[model samples]
Target chain A: MNRYTDEERQLDELLRSASPRRTVPPGLDTRIMARIAAHERRRRERRAIRSMALTCLALSAVLAVVGGIAVRSLDVVHRPETLVLLLAGMGCMALTVGGDRIGEIMRRL
Target chain B: MEQPTDNEIVQRVAAGDTEAFGIVVARYSEPIYHLVAGILRNEARAEEVTQETFVRAYEHLDRFRGGCSLSTWLYRIAYNRAVDSCRRRRFFGLLPAHETLPEPDDRPRYDDETIDRMRRALGRLAPRERALIALFYEEERPIAEVAAITGLSPANVKVKLHRTRQLLRKYMETQ
Candidate 1:
């Protein structure tokens, strides 16, 4: 064997150990799993609410169209030459986007 | 009776028994951790990377083809996560994500003879180079396995492994 220093071998021996590995705390798994479960619950609720909102908005849109048509038919019966009510309905439709000045933001978004 | 295979756990996880995935985490976390720690070197960040690996694995399990072993797939995820964590550490101007070895007299266990010196030397290598050495020395992967895990061809792995060793040797000698 090549000449070996005692101190060097001792140091090499000392440095050659590996620490025992510990797992991430068990609670970490529970917390993460719990969060995933809760997130799924929240996601379903959010999707349901979004679908309901879309349905309500669609119903409102259909009602607006039908009411405008009904008013136009009335205008024809009462004062056939007048564009007043139809023009008013057109203005109402222009303001169709309804939640707190949403029309202005919708143009940008 | 057969104990559950990783593929079985994975299939259950995909079928919506999210809690069933904890078994997968519990089983693989240590190997996944050592692999991450080997590459990134910070114990705390390695723990975070291990956790994120499972999270990403869960998120992407549907895309996992059964052609490869589960651990191989997880290694791929862990590797990508470690790389991202390394980038984040660098971008934040933090010290590279590596653990400080205790003094030889102080640390009870160290597998690398020059643990501290090697770590300091490792810093000089590019991340991919460091990763290759780590997969060899730390993860104990053979060149073939390392190539499979890192997606390098065996020939490329050998070439890269040679350069990696030379770079570390240079660092050790110079340092």
Candidate 2:
């Protein structure tokens, strides 16, 4: 047991001496801060694009609904098939307005 | 003026005062670098991993509930990052043969060739074991904190650390 303690002590000293505290390179903090800034900028840009895409999607849906109701109340089409066709046209318009935005958001993601 | 505690800095950063994060980065970067460099044994990769650790901690600050000290959380991130970097290097077969060998600066400081042997022995140990050594000996962390950083139970940490020391001794004797 005594020999073990002695050996452990020697090893401890040896390890300590062998592995001195490594010095960090200069400007490491600057480099890290720069990276953090870049990351923050990217995050902000992503959030802005996402929010804009959501707004466009909401606007397109509202326009489609309002356009459909207006056409239905006008009674321009006597047939249910005509009303369905009008709604489908409005739906196509909405997709045209918002499709690219959605695609952009998806690609970014 | 007294410097703010880590919790205080964290609160400030979470409150949208992003500059306060610089304090955390500056305060922890060196020790994180040492711990990471010890594990990866590559200064450049260690630096990159250290920066990555801070960036990850910043992004995930909301998840920090103060269950552990900030340094412990940061150490955990740095350790995992270094390990991942090591794995990636190994996968690409780009890991150097002497990744963990001691630097040439030690030649003048320690005249004994045993120091070289000891460093070579350290290189032979697995990366996880080297992490345990760095956290235990270099950081002088308590077993419990080491456990927290390494995701090991305290009992496991103790056993592994004991075995690591014994292995180091054996290597030193035989090498």
Candidate 3:
């Protein structure tokens, strides 16, 4: 243990003299910040696209249900898939609201 | 007013204040660069890896729960980035394993020539060993901090550090 201590001291001294602490080059912070800003922009764009898609899906689901109800009232169709339209609308609503949570889960994966 | 702490800076960044992250970059860029350069032995590559580390930290700022100090967290990220870069280089055969030099039976000296030998010896060490030396000696971090950066237990850090010290001594003392 004493020998280890002695060696450790010598090694520490040698490394200190040989490899002094380096200074970061000028503009490194700027370069890093630029990259970070670009990444943030890309992430925001992706989220916007996701939100738009979800909203479209929900709106389309709503239109399908309204059309089904109108057709049922018209009494022209023998069978109206009102139940399926309601289930689709509910699923799309959940997806639109829970999009962020789903994103977090996917990122973890 | 007194300077806000690292947690404060992290919180500000997480709160959508993008400019606040520049403070984190300015504060840790130097030591993180030094640690990465020591591990990589390449200044340009170290700079690139340092930038990547900060970007990664920024991206995950919301996930930082402050279980450890900001410096420790940054050091851990920097260390991992450096190691991953090394692995990728090795995988593509871009970096060759450093060859060991023959030993001589003379007392070690700390001259310029000896410094050159020390550098070569450092290059011969594994990336993880270099990281241990950088955090413990160059950065002057405690054993616990070193363990945190390397994801090793404190006892494991001590044992690995002891063996690395001996290996470095032997390599530098060689002809």
Candidate 4:
């Protein structure tokens, strides 16, 4: 029986044996690639959803800004109309930011 | 063209060149195998989990950002699956259900039967504890990476790893 602790030595041997460069079963490469392909497909789907969200946010920003600006010109209540437009602009920015944050989180897949 | 780097391979895989992913898998299979096998202590189960690791990684490949190292991401999947399998086995009473259990790797071989006694002693440690040793020694991961892979905070990992090492060292001594 090996009586001494030699724990440190044993550890070194263990580490060396387990190094990532060790040979694996043949054709594991193929299996892994097949797996990655499936994963990428899912990832692409998520990207599409995120793109859709971004598109909605952009359209909403333009509509809100243009409508708010045109309303201010016609109403003649410059202060209130201006304030509303600025608030709408801020809201659009926030919506875009929120969607971006969520998109980043979802991208974690 | 120059041989593609790991990052390049990953990016290509991300770009939907599925074959490039073979490089990634071939790169890590051996280590991942040892990681899961060492933790689960069942060669067959380890192989199953290792295969599942790739399957799960594939299922969620789109969400993988390059923030953390790719190896770290793969280790995280391996660790989580090992933990889940242990929990499921426990809950299902697939094991003793009542008898006191040993550490994972129910049948570790010892050299010339001299270390066979020590093998049983080592098996007394918990799966997570055993996992720490395997990660540190077999995976050659730094403490910080082990913390990330195991989902323990660095400080906590340090404490657990230190304590686990001491236990193994001491256990080996007495045997």
Best by DockQ: 2
Cα-based TM-score, every candidate:
0.68, 0.84, 0.79, 0.59
I-RMSD for candidate 3: 6.9
Can you write out model 4's per-residue Cα lDDT over B25-83, one digit (the tens) per residue?
77788888888766766656777788889878766777788778888999989988986
Residue-level lDDT of model 2, residues B93-147, one tens digit each, is 9977787454545434456687778787787778899899888887788999999
Q: What is the TM-score of chain B alone in each candidate?
A: 0.85, 0.91, 0.89, 0.81
lDDT of each: 0.67, 0.84, 0.81, 0.69
Model 3 Cα displacement at B56 (Å)? 1.2
RMSD of each: 7.0, 4.0, 7.5, 10.3
Tell me the docking grade of candidate 4. incorrect
For candidate 2, give the docking quality class from DockQ: acceptable
* Regions of candidate 3 where Cα sits further than 4 Å from its true position: A1-8, A75-109, B96-109
lDDT of 3 at B147: 91
Worst window of 10 by summed lDDT in candidate 2 chain B: B100-109
Point to the candidate with the largest lDDT.
Answer: 2
Residues A65-88, candidate 1, lDDT per residue (tens digit)? 876676656744566434566556
Q: What proportion of the real contacts between chains A and B does each prediction keep?
A: 0.13, 0.56, 0.75, 0.33
lDDT of 4 at B49: 85
Query: Which window of ten consecutive residues has the lowest lDDT sum in model 3 chain B?
Result: B99-108
**Candidate number that wins on DockQ, 1 or 3:** 3
| Deviation of model 3 at B58, angstroms | 1.3
Worst 10 residues of 4 chain B by lDDT: B97-106
Per-candidate count of clashing residue pairs (backbone under 3 Å): 4, 0, 0, 6
